[model samples]
Target: MATYDLIVVGAGALGAFHAYHAAKAGQRVLLLEKDQYPIGATVRNFGQVVPSGLAGRWFEYGRRSLEIYRDIQSQTDLTVRANGTVYIASDSDEWVLANELYDRYQAIGYPCELLSKLQCLTKYPLLQPDYVVGGLFFPDELSVEPEQMIHRLIAFAQKKYGVDYRPGSVVVDCQSNYGGAILTLANKQRFQAGRVLICSGHEVRLLFPEQLADAGLVVSKLQMLLVEPVAGVTLPGNMLTGLTIRRYESFQECPSYASIPKPEHLAELQKWGIHILFKQAIDGSFIVGDSHEYADATKAEDLGFHTQDYINQLMLTEARRIVTFPLEVRKTWAGFYSQTKAEIFEYDVDENIRIITGIGGKGMSSGAGYAEASIREMGL
Candidate 1:
């Protein structure tokens, strides 16, 4: 059989982006997925591409991803909409962080708008006036329907870049040689590639369990809800609240962040890691979420499979406090993603085999840009 230039395992956002970049660079690529479609963290996310929430290299990656996403949208429909992102501060302390973050972005020459309480109310009528003081807005950010975007992206890559995409093909084995790597499917069929990149999200036991067990990866379980479409309620873009302003990594970069006094009243929210955010779907329903719960990758089961009603209640209680529109939870589910203390997990099994996963919530924000850099670094 002919050896391809690259083989990407797992056609999720991370893997698909890596394949996209390599194929775009004129490399022969093979993309494989065990499932009929990507249904992991890639599709089960808020789909908010808010680089404003990131810091350091990831911030840079997110910025680049914005361009890549916009470029792709220009080519075909990826469900990408440039509506923007806003962080509405509820109190003086959170407002302080918002202003500081705005100033930080200004210094870096990134475009951002500082909105007055009146401007915020005018722009987003659903926000509760009492709950919002002032806001920091990034007009360049985007929102996507995760399921639609990933599927469309795969199709676009296949048509435009000539990528060989095989879905529902389970990879049973991976072995590396000096020339490249070999992958065996569950049906006993095999394929060869000059290099193999595993972007398998949180499922690590299939290939290199030993390397991953000690890779310092932790699986984060996030709970989210979908509110039934409230008629005539238009909450534009990504509506992030005081809790999000206080929790996002970008706010931590501000000089005043370290000293901002925590609100004792929100102790329970802190305990549950709840951050209230709202995004309107094309059908007019509001997508609301989410709370973070974690366990070591090897013990991801500890995070549990059942949805905790208490967590959903906590999120709804907080969301109702921020928006005026009625929130009748229509659906709720849990999303799993892997994360480490570092930005992302990268391991090399040999010269031709590499493992990249554990991007956390930054996958949609930074995956394209990071994968581009990764492909270039590998000289693919």
Candidate 2:
């Protein structure tokens, strides 16, 4: 058996970050992925690294993740662009919540600006004038190319940090003991390590299905779209509409969050759990998404991995209403992540085995920081 300091499963954003942190700390880590490369929720959603939207420990982690990103990028070629983010409000109701969040940011002395209708349009001229009343511009937020960031991160870890990355390996059997854990791969290969960190998102069942099930793990499905870029289109950063205010937990910290005004005209949209966000990819093509649905976490794949036309129609309709770009759905798909009622579901099954997944949609936003903290707290 090849022994190492730590073993990581999943190889997604969370797993990759865990392995990266472990390796950076001088721990020899064996990072395993079931697929040849990760094609799960990690790469499927918008790569918006917005620390300003996270609160408490997660917010701190996000800041650390940014620092780490810069650290790694300085030593290597991984790129994290400072594109920033803007949350636009279409009417008085969304504007009410927007100001509430801005007030909280002002009180905390965060470097962010609340933009009036004129300023918002001046910044992002691409936006439809009638659709935006105001916006909150978070200049510190960063973004990455979601589809390629992990693959590049994995390469950086392996080349620069010497993290032993093993792709296309699935752990069929995992046995934990006081001294260490033994993982048996489907190909009958075995790896022994002092501890195991399971960051497997939906596949946590492959290792500890019982723990995941007992934790009441549910799957949150998101239907997303990538629209063909217009001949000439530009955005301030990632754009979050009024829907995100109700969806993201960070906004809850504002004193007026609980009592933020609600626009009754959007009742139907809210009923379907639809939210609109626009992010421009590195290639300049825009990514627009998304609608949410819930199902038994274990049955998410059985539900299908393709987009639902009805949901996409609803999403595109809303997207058009918010901004105009001669939008055409160049591509459509669905991604699912583990969801729980808690901030994040991280647990230790034993002295030598740990699990960290079920971060919901925040994985792309605050995941790296969360993983770094997890490694430090465990003294790994």
Please report the candidate that would top lDDT against the real structure: 1
Total clashes, candidate 2? 0
Model 2: CA > 4 A from native: none
Candidate 2 minimal-lDDT segment of 10 residues: 254-263
- Candidate 1, residues 143-203, lDDT tens digits: the string is 9998799999999999999999999989989998777999999999899999999999999
Off by over 4 Å in 1: none
> Largest TM-score belongs to which candidate?
1
| Residue 230 miss distance in model 1 (angstroms) | 1.2
User: Which lDDT values do the candidates have, in the order given?
Assistant: 0.92, 0.84
- Model 2, residue 133: distance off in Å is 1.1
Residue 235, model 2, lDDT: 70
